[model samples]
Target: MTQITFKQGWRQLISGLADLRLAIILLLSIALFSISGTIIEQGQSVSFYQNNYPEDPAILGFLSWKVILTLGLDHVYTTWWFVTLLVVFGSSLTACSFTRQLPTLKSARRWQYYKRPSQFEKLALSTELSYLTLDQLIPELKQHRYKIFQEGNQLYARKGIMGRIGPIVVHISMLIILVGAIWGAFTGFMAQEMVATGETFQVKNIFEAGKLSKAQIPQDWQVRVNDFWIDYTQEGEIDQFYSDLSVVDLKGNELKQETIHVNQPLRYDGVTFYQTDWGIAAVTVQINNSPIFRLPMAKLNQEGEGNLWGTWVPIKPDLSQGVSLLTRDLKGTLLVYDTAGKLTGVVRPGMGIEVEGITLKVQKLIGSTGLQIKADPGIPIVYTGFGLLMVGVVMSYVSHSQIWALKVDNSLYLGGKTNRAQVGFEQEFLAILTALEKQQPQLVTSSSEKG
Candidate 1:
């Protein structure tokens, strides 16, 4: 007996670990972590932490490598503690269902009638009418579309007992989703890159920085950016942004092309790409002389540089000196130099400064375009979980009921019960009993005969 007690205790402990309470607690914890991730800007640079929390001792202390390593907060969801919590919750649910729920379901499936007077007295809806016998009750319940069952001197009636499994099914679906999420987090990869319009590069890393260990790009996919465009409102607010993207197969042939926008993402080979952002970038500069085409010279340079200078010597014998030029702030300064490279006067854009012999003018400023690239592999699992969760919720809210009847000594007894959605079930039960009274010829006759 002691051994049996010990075993039972151990089983209960295991079952409790897998209970819905544990799953709820774990889910709440995950929610907290998600909230924390949102509130704390992720993927920020080290300098961002320095700038944002400079004097905050706690933040500064948490930013240290030791604390990050110990807490695994850098990659919260993937951390051992978080994963352990998920595993424990999942195990608890499975254990609870296996040890407790399965047996309960089995017993519910077995035929057992409610006959105890004390039980009947305890019920919220109980009626004792002399006219109703077990036989009449059974047929009436059958007419009402309830599954009927009988035991000696007792009647077990049920309808929609299948609804009892709704919570379990929902829980199982959640477990599947959790498993998928964990699998993706461990094996899946995500990475982002910024490309100028018409520029492309292979994704070489999985994470923004050191948040998670880097993962390799999958072998079958090669992504390229064909074009990026941003449409803006008349008031200068951004209206929409999109990227034209192409995917190449392993053989270097284009497999697919798609236009992806902010919310609408491009999916290929189990991966999805989203257009996250766009920026101005990679500008080049050019210099051309104005008014006369004598010395046409063009120079290319990166934007935002401090200085630009160029010189042009005339080919004509009559023109002995060359023009010296400098450009700043979209303006040009021109100076003339003697054949010997001597001191010259300055000139600005559209204005000629007398130098060794000529005048110069500024021509153009060009701009480059930039686009943001991103890919996530966990989306499919997340979406599948969402779909199943909705289904489970709907099933749980719809109750299943059954009614049974038995005849003994020319008297009828009726029994009925539902798995869930009790209020609606009760209302339906009442409606069915009322219909039986009005429709059944023998039902009223039996009641009067008994009276």
Candidate 2:
């Protein structure tokens, strides 16, 4: 009795999980949470959230930085709650497939011959014809491409069985997609890097990483920025930027080289680097017969104007007197400023300007490339699942129709039904009945001689 009760409980659980309404609700909930993830920027520092979502004037009157952090909104995709939702939803799909879709498909494949004339009356379309033979009906069903089965006097035919299998395929595809999403959430990582020209660096500055993402981070190789440059339009506007990058091994051997721009990226060892941004790194200058020096440039916030980079150069050995140099582009134009913040002179590359009894010659401006790198191993599985999903959707559109014919005492009882496309199925059934009617005279003469 205990074993029977346990089995009943298990069956009830499966049946509840297969409910269509429950599946729809879970699907909508997942979509709502995913939208929240997009709205709340994922993978940001605590200071960023504190400044953006202050407690005094919380967004939506309730969402503050404290609330965001407490709920793990900074990295919503890998959150425990989000992962749990995925697992539960996947279980629902699995139960529905086994308890509903699979059983329906199995029932459709099995032969179901109508042995009594009363069964014909229960169908959507049924008819009676005198002196009709199974041999005559077999030819008509074959012409319609229907698979036939006969037992003594009862006959059954069916077509478009793929329509029954389509739902199962769709369920399998959903399960595959869910598995891919969960796997990626636990194994992928994202990082950003700002590399200057002629500089080699390894992957660091990771802002987001899954629990199992350590192995995904590149530790065997490094990347070098060979050069960085930008193209300007005739109107002095920025057109595009390019970065020539090389993949190198530990011993500094070049493994690959490519020029990447906005949409193009470099892929190596399961990690992908995308060109996202650019900036001025530093400027090289010569202090009148002295050794060349590379001074780091910093971006200045100027209202109304675009990006501007500035740096200070000391003309005196004691560093008591200096000049502020600023530029808006890599075209070698430099705006010089005196110690009192007055405009002193405008200098270009290889040109010298006198300041504080010393000459400073402007050299070339160095540029840096901003790259967003990511590693995702589940992308292929997700793509394949989507492909199978499309095939399943197309197959589900075909109608699964079945026909039954029972010859009883010189009269033919015929009936047919379809899972979908009722109007089309009815028309086809009528056409077969008309064909049989046309052969009624020949059938009558043969029946009379046999009697």
Candidate 3:
């Protein structure tokens, strides 16, 4: 009695896990938390959340920066609970596929030869033809592309078996997607770099990185920005831009090179570099009586004009009086300011402006390119899952169909069934019956051929 009880309990547990309801609930839970991860920015600095989702103004009055930190909301995808959900979902798919889909497919494949003509009444469509034999009926069923199985005076046939396998394929593809997402969550990293032209830099400044993704990070190779330039329309608005980039080995050998722009990116090994933003890093100018000097420019935030850089050039030895050189863009005007905070003059590139009784020439501006880089190991698997999903969806539409025929005494019994597209299947089944009806004339056939 105890052994039977344990067996029944175990079967009940398996049934519960394999239930469609359980799978739906788990899927909904995963989607809800995934949405939360998107709404609350992930991998932001502590100070960032502290400002936006502060303790007092706490977003939604309950979710503060502290709560995000404590609950690991910043890295929801890689968190234990999230991964656990993925694992459980995958397991549910496996269990459901094994317990339900596979068995359903197996049942579809295994044919049952109708031992009695009365079985035809159990089908959705059945009838008795007055004058039909095995030879006349076989040809009509053959035209319909059904595989035939026969015993003496009995017939079974089926087609569109893909409809049975389609569900299994869909379940397997879903499992593949879940595994890919979990893999990416544990092994992907995102980093941002602001590099000046002609400068080489290694991958660092990781804004978001997986816990075990150190190996996937670019460590051996470096990136060099050969040149950076922008294209502008007649209205002086940016039309597009380009960044000439190269992947370099540690020993100074070139690996891959390309001219990347917006919507275009450079890929090396497993990492991808995207041109995301741009900035001005420094300016070159000629101070009075000083060799053409290059001074680092500090970017400023101004009203109505966004991209602006400024630098103070000392015209006096005491460094007391200097001109504030403010620039609008790399190729635009430079505003000169006196020590009294008055805009003295406007100077274009290669032009001179009088400041503190001396001519200060604006020479050129150097530009910096901002690049965002990322590497995800599971992208291929994810794409493969997507392909499988499309194939499975198409296969699902084929319509699993079945038919049965039995000969009792001098009459041929015919019936049909389908798992989907029943109206279409019915039309085809009726057409086959009509064809058989035309050939219903009696014919002689050997009973030994029934095998």
Candidate 2 local lDDT, 327-368, one digit each (tens): 998877999898888988999988999876678898889999
Q: Which portions of model 1 miss their true places by more than 4 Å?
A: 1-12, 19-24, 43-48, 55-70, 114-123, 129-139, 150-155, 208-216, 249-252, 289-378, 419-423, 439-451
Q: What digit string (tens of lDDT, one per residue) describes model 1 on residues 320-363?
A: 54444433322223444545666565554344344333333433
Per-candidate TM-scores read: 0.70, 0.93, 0.93
Query: What's model 1's lDDT at 196?
Result: 54
User: What is the Cα root-mean-square deviation between model 3 and the actual structure?
Assistant: 4.1
Point to the candidate with the largest lDDT: 2
Between prediction 1 and prediction 2, which has the larger TM-score? 2
Per-residue lDDT of candidate 3, residues 1-451 (tens digit): 9999999998887888898899999999999999999999989999999988989977788999999999889999999999999998898898899899999998998888887777777788777776577777787778889888888888888889998898899999998898888888788899999888889999989988878789999889999999888898999988887899999999878999999998999988989999998887777888776898878888787776677778888888798887788876666577889988899989887888877788888887778899999999889889889899989988988887888888878778888788888788878877876676556446432111010
User: What does candidate 1 score in Cα RMSD to the true structure?
Assistant: 8.4
Q: Compute the lDDT for candidate 2.
A: 0.89
The whole-model lDDT of each prediction reads 0.58, 0.89, 0.85
Minimum summed lDDT over a 10-residue window in model 2 is located at: 442-451
